[model samples]
Target: MIILGIDPGIADTGFGVISAEKSTFKAITYGTIKTSKADDLAKRLDYLYKDIEKLIKKHKPSKIGIESIFFAKNAKTAITIAHARGICLLAAQQAKAQIHEYTPLQIKQALTGYGAADKNQIQQMVKTILNLKEIPKPDDAADALACAICCAQTKQYV
Candidate 1:
């Protein structure tokens, strides 16, 4: 099965694509989608949507694992992230892929066996689990890979 994982953000959305069969997993691709703050919100979202749609069309992943928004002290920031996340969801839906949502805590625990694991810990685990020579560049991309691994480990898919 091919799975795509997304870590959504207004400025940078991270994406990781992996192929899984039984207990084996392989990283197909991973990267970040960047948008400048200089652009208007509508334009940024449109760009994000189009890029994500292109990814779906190219990879044709059967399932998508997306991190759910965690509300911070800043409500405005959370709302912006929600908008980016919604674009990701819309792209997945348009592609007719099964969507799976995982909270930050769930992803961390699944990846590092600790809900409060730090970013470094999660990144290390992602590299080790994927058997990569180096940790995926950009923290967001590693987080996205963690999401994919988490979804694959879930009983629903197993």
Candidate 2:
């Protein structure tokens, strides 16, 4: 199964693609979609939408796993992230891929066997699970890959 995982944000949306077979997961591609700071919020979102659509078309993933929105102390940041996440979900729906959502706690637990695992612990697990030399760059991209790993791990039980 090919799974695309997304960690959405207005400025830097993270994306990771992985292929899973027989309980083994391999990272295909991972990166961040960055929008210029000079661009307005609407323009940034438009860029994100188009880029995500292209990514979906190119990868043709069987499913998409995205991190659920976690409440933030800054309501404005949370609202903006919610909008970005909505567009990502829409892109997955349009591509007709099965969509799965996981929380940060769930992803950490799946990857590290600890629900309250720190970011470094999760990154280390992601690196070890995929047999990569180092953690993927940009914390968001690592988190996105972790989300994909979580989905791959839970697929059998679900």
Candidate 3:
């Protein structure tokens, strides 16, 4: 199955696409969607919506795995991310893709067997899981790949 994973952010939304069979994952593509702070919030969200929609149309993923929102230190920042996340959920729904949301801790634990695993540890696991030469780039894309790996392990396609 082609699984599309997303780590949503207002400024830089990370996305990764991978093919999964049972527990094995092979990376297809990974990148970030950057939005300008100079643009209005609505325009930024619209850009995200359009870009994500394009990705779905391009990849035709069977399902989507998204990182769920957790408590953030900055309330305003959290709210901003929630907006981006909302657009992602909306896009998946509109595409008729099965959606699964995972918490950061759940993703870490699934990949590393430890919920408290740090970013480097989780990225290392992602690298190993996908059999990549290095951790996926730009941190956020690696995080999205990790979320996909978690769902690939925990969720059964059949």
What is the C-alpha local distance difference test score of each model?
A: 0.92, 0.91, 0.92
lDDT of 3 by residue, 1-158 (tens): 99899999999999999999876789999989999999999999999999999999999998899999988989998999999999999999999998999999999999999999999999999899889998889999999998878878885555
Distance (Å) between predicted and true CA of 5, model 2?
A: 0.6
Q: Itemize residue pairs with steric clashes in candidate 1.
A: none
lDDT of 1 by residue, 39-154 (tens): 99999999999999998999999889999986667999999999999999999998999999999999998988899999999999989888999999998898899999988887
Q: What is the Cα-based lDDT of residue 96 in candidate 1?
A: 92
Q: Ten residues in a row with the worst lDDT in model 3?
A: 149-158
For residues 17-52, what per-residue lDDT tens digits would candidate 2 score against the true structure? 999998788999999999999999889988999999
Steric clashes per prediction? 0, 0, 0
- How displaced is residue 12 in candidate 3, in Å? 0.5
lDDT of 1: 0.92
Clashing pairs in 3: none
User: Where does model 2 exceed 4 Å of error?
Assistant: 156-158
- What lDDT is reached at residue 130 by model 3? 88
The collision pairs in model 2 are none
